[model samples]
Target: MGRTVRVIAALGLAVLPGTTAHAAAQAARPPRAVAPALTAPAAPALRRSAWTGTWEAAPSGTAPALPGAAIRNVVHLSTGGNAVRVRLSNRLGTAPLRLGAVTVALRRAAGPDAAPGTLRTATFHGAPTITVAPGRDLLTDPVPLPVRAGADLLVTVHTPDDDGPATFHRQAMQTSYVARSGAGAAQDESGAAYTATTGSWYYVTGVDVRGSATGSVAAFGDSLTDGVGATTDADRRWPDRLAEHLRVRRVGVLNAGISGNRLLRDGTGPSGLSRLDADALDRAGVRVLVVFEGINDIINTPGPTATALTDAYRTLVARAHARGIPVVGVTLTPYRGHRLFDAAREALRQQVNTFIRTGGAFDAVADADAALRDPADPQRLLPGYDQGDHLHFNDTGLLAVADTVGRVLDHRFVGRAAGVRVLR
Candidate 1:
């Protein structure tokens, strides 16, 4: 009874106004315990992504200036990634090229219009604009836009000042739009402001994706690889067909072909030897190189001899080997009726083709000749394959070339990356 009375007295002191009474009651009470702080759960590890080349156009040369105009280049991609980025070149520019705005968006029905919500403004090191120096190039910072394979994307470049000799790919074989008024129409989602069309690609050269693609295959060659005879806007280039075939492998195909390109020396663009590094070996995730050159060299006079050509092939292979990249030697295809065809040229072409097939100078060979040649004539393109030029191949012929490459690559490098080469 006395203890209960003491407890009641202590409770009464706690309620009292005086600090002395409160202190006495507090001192009499047991100590309170502290609760442990709550800990946050650990975060999951981020998935790693690699930059892969899904689409590319090697800069061929320069075009006239397009000052204060926004040029929208429509590019068809081979593969896709989680995010996207683009490469613009000034490789042939005589002066600095200043870009006011660089934007990308999904195309709406093959026009300059962007899909409802896919426009993305690309920055250069966090700045929305960039100035590329002469004989130089720039890559945009990655945009957080998920892209898909086989998408037709619009990469628009707004040049505030004269930006030419604009680094360009001469034979785009696809339609692109231009807004001749000013830079304000660059990011415009509607196609209203774009009133002009072109058959070449300017400023933008390559499209890279942040995704799981292992690497890319570069189709380095001439008009055959550049789709000279294939229908424009149809994506019927042999390289394009090759991309569709490569979709399952999660690999990309980059067409580095320039129409009239040659093997030993420069003509339409830099010779295969001159541009190999930039066009193939140094490209993003380039695991293999497929050279489909030599046709123009054979057609054009002052051409290399069979020995000189094969020796050049040896040099190209050696250089590619230096970079740990294997080379594939494609046999030179037949050209019997073209204006430049002659007995000597035909014999020389035969010698080169023979070497390509058995010289063992390359890591692998994709016999575009066997696939494109007339079994009946052996010295001419199969009639259906020929684009009436006896040299260039039509869409069906492009598919044939693509199939030949696909077959050899599949056999030699299925589930892996090996070199590829094509002859046209």
Candidate 2:
């Protein structure tokens, strides 16, 4: 038997300042499950305020499973809290994924060393060990710890036996460690046992913290949002930069980007339309959704038209509004020298960007194209920001994109989102 794991990417769209971009047509597909505009969920329980997303890496694809081997994923946080919890998924597994041990702790330095007195074992349903069924998600009970935002945390997982494909997020950009022995060393705080290193995040999907921040912002899109061009372990992805800006305000940012992903169909993980809820809308304390994608859709084979892409944006926005979560759209940036660049595709990109800016589909707009494009030639990426790939941005380019996003989701936007409604 076989299963298909959808690769979801972000759409390159934008919202006008306190105004809606209007598009009248069946451009967008029929609302699968559209949410009302500017509505947040009703009065909530303690759990509602108990957890806010600090970090995330959307599962991009599966890899061969490693039984009896322990995996330690080094992750960075956007915000910290009093208590923390981890979420693991087997959504793409063909068989049950067994956990022998799981641990979370603050990092002492870089490598795999855990800070003293901070290592904590994770439990599911009060049990230290449990089986995560295929196509399912499980959350570890919250551990009481002082989690500092902008810090690194080590989430280590050990499997006693191989089950099926290992659900993982590729392009972690950060290095992780693996222990080949049955000891897994998952319970060890020392780095000596973890002799091997890997670039992808395994099993572990998200990290959430309780207290400190009231809500978070989800950065949804493609490789640009995923930090493809950023330095390893530097946390300089545009989303990471945005998180730094939001830190002072106590807001978290989640980066959910799938490289080579598209908005209309699955290529890397799941299509853009299929991942909105998991990547953004449904996340803990998610108040805003910002998207920057669609280059793949335009440059890839048999790409989507401006109309098709815009309709998809409208559908995504409608669903977000129904849940009372405000959507912020970002225009696509320039990519002139890329291998896939072409005149027709470039024209399509421009058309889609126009709709994103003036189509009345979003609540706020960030002109990423204008911010990162060369004034001498609007079609080309600014020389300072180019990651050398023309398509992706370097650290400087990442910062530029971050500035564009922050300019729109500024204090005024944050204030309005807070009072508009609670997210459902």
Candidate 3:
């Protein structure tokens, strides 16, 4: 009845003496036919939805205006994507700021010019040009520019109107190019027209890219986090180094540090508490915060106590937790030999660090003090890491701090879906 039995009967093979009837029948049957192979389905296309902050510089103060001139700012991106957008600020400008043109391109090197065939023009609401009012920021429409992590982007803006007081980040260690009024170099691929160089970033504040990343981490601190003592044009800041360490991971590192920034009151820039929302929380896809402030408040300012500073830290932690982003507290480094160092300030620094280490207030602790402090003279920085200022770290010190932070982040976030609230 079955196919095998029919084949065996038709073949007429004799049954062996030792073999069973089923085995003899199967041996006489013809081979079975094989089924045809199947084709696999094509993979679905990925959707472009999430965006991350690839590069950022918190606007600290106002820079001189570039009336009828083109200014090009070079920024280092922490993550790459298929499309890019830029955030420009007139936060300190007195009058409306008008722009004639705006362009973004991938830089071939550290200089002003972009690589050929990689330049792209950015638009705002489908318009080529826009006017930004005082105390406001404008985000350009997404431009199709493929970028790799750690790529340097040259953003050129042509200002036709007199921008009164340009909102800027004053401590950009990297050099940027500028063309005078008569020299229009916004679209120049060869950087020949850019004659002047500056160390500040004007107008542009942040750059966001569409990518598959979990989110970004904002380094909220003062000059040490701002890369003050690192060499010019070298992306050796602790946050820059952290970005490099996290390039293969799905995370972005944004440097929101302002030189001389204080945690308690306004100083070189807005206080850490005042600008936390704008600088850290509101950034594109920011998931974590790292606070390395309070040194300036303890040494340079008055009316700050250990209790007050730790209370301020508590406030920062609470605020970030409300937005579902964890905060990592960094222990302040030693500054015993600096001009501002005093017994009272050193005592306060020790008290605050004790609380940071044992109080269980922050979600994580980076222990920067232990990493950079001298073993012989615990109240001062290690001789090799010190930049001679006693307060800031050199390139080597910066790398050490970055490595510690990177390890902490990796242990907390990588390969884990749920966020961890506390890390020693």
Candidate 4:
């Protein structure tokens, strides 16, 4: 008999900022003081817990097609949060955008299972809001919030924002619709919290607690792992599915994938290497890390740059390891006949994959390529799992990626996921 151990990777997509060439040059500062020492003793054998969830905003009607601001799944917190982090996007925008008064409050309940009308309020570094420029991501200064898990929170924004045709992963977990000013979500209640408005319009994608996490995993990579082209509102992104897997086994998963992102240079989103802190490491309770990146570096960026890409990856691996957190390298999936197919690019991908397979620098490695590649085509997605784009994965494809990592983390795939503890 076979056993399943679900595994979750807190992956971030390629979130690029729309900074001007001049601004980027000026803003580039040295790596912030080697991230404060997060030295923890060998992790105890403990079960997992649902720690945090991600949320983004969807564009509303007549909302200026801000090049990078058309984000789907905006999030709001209510009732039980103190210190919260808001995700400011520049993923698809062309120029840097700035945000002003971004507020969080309780929305009125609109359903049978609604909580209460009045709820707790959140602070932006004890102020009202902070600013996030394009092509760049920012983490707000932690604020003392008082909220619990599963509470409804309202995240509001008003600013001189740029717009663009952004890409979003639609899922059913808990995303809202976006109107001009309000996110069409159930009104949040405090005393009698329950579901109210059934169908909401704001794209309030995700909201999660920051207190319940034991540790986190950063699954950084391109679209194949990011769950692109999957059903909207299904939450079928491999990371989402992985989170469910973690719930069963007692773990926390954070999704940080951006479509069209690369490891070496910028692609559709910000370069994988550049968005590390915002996407993965900087979170309060981060522990393990899984890097499933580099496909874009090989296939999309400057050709025949495998050596440079490898060197950059080495730097990334070294940085994470220096922090005492284990870094897991995932092999790149094959892209045999996509429009960007190139023999040279394919060669670079194979080289990087080879390094991941044999590179001892990584605490562990997941052979993601073997999990989804066709036995015959080898370079193309396995039959029945392709999203038809030949670049990204379908729901089935996402599951395959999850399964591969699941098995790599723990011999089991379900019932008892990675970091599981069986109580007698």
Top model number, TM-score: 2
lDDT of 1 by residue, 1-424 (tens): 0011111132221110111222233223332221111111111221237788889898777789899989999999888888898888877688888889999998989788999899999987677886776766557889988888899999999998975588899899999999997578888989899999999999888898887666777888888888999999999999999999988767789998899888777667777766766667667776667877887888787877887787667766655555555566678888898888898888888888888887767777888898889998999999999999898999999999999988877766554333422211
Taking the tens digit of each residue's C-alpha lDDT, what string does model 4 give over 254-277? 555655666655545456665554
Give the alpha-carbon lDDT of every model: 0.77, 0.80, 0.78, 0.49
**Count of clashing residue pairs in every prediction:** 2, 29, 0, 99
Better of 3 and 4 by TM-score: 3
Best by lDDT: 2
Cα lDDT tens digits, model 2, 266-373, are 779877876666667666777788888898999999988888899888888877776666778899998999899999999999999998888778777789999999
For candidate 3, write residues 47-80 as lDDT tens digits. 2357888888988889778888888899999888
Once superposed on the true structure, which residue ranges of model 4 sit more than 4 Å away at CA?
A: 1-120, 125-154, 160-176, 181-208, 411-424
Taking every candidate in turn, the Cα RMSD to the unseen true structure, in Å, is: 23.1, 7.9, 22.6, 10.1
Candidate 1, run of 10 with poorest lDDT: 34-43
**Root mean square deviation (Cα) for candidate 1:** 23.1
TM-score of 4: 0.66
Taking all chains together, each candidate's TM-score versus the true structure is 0.86, 0.88, 0.86, 0.66
> For candidate 1, what is the TM-score?
0.86
Question: Positional deviation of 302 in candidate 2, in angstroms?
Answer: 1.2
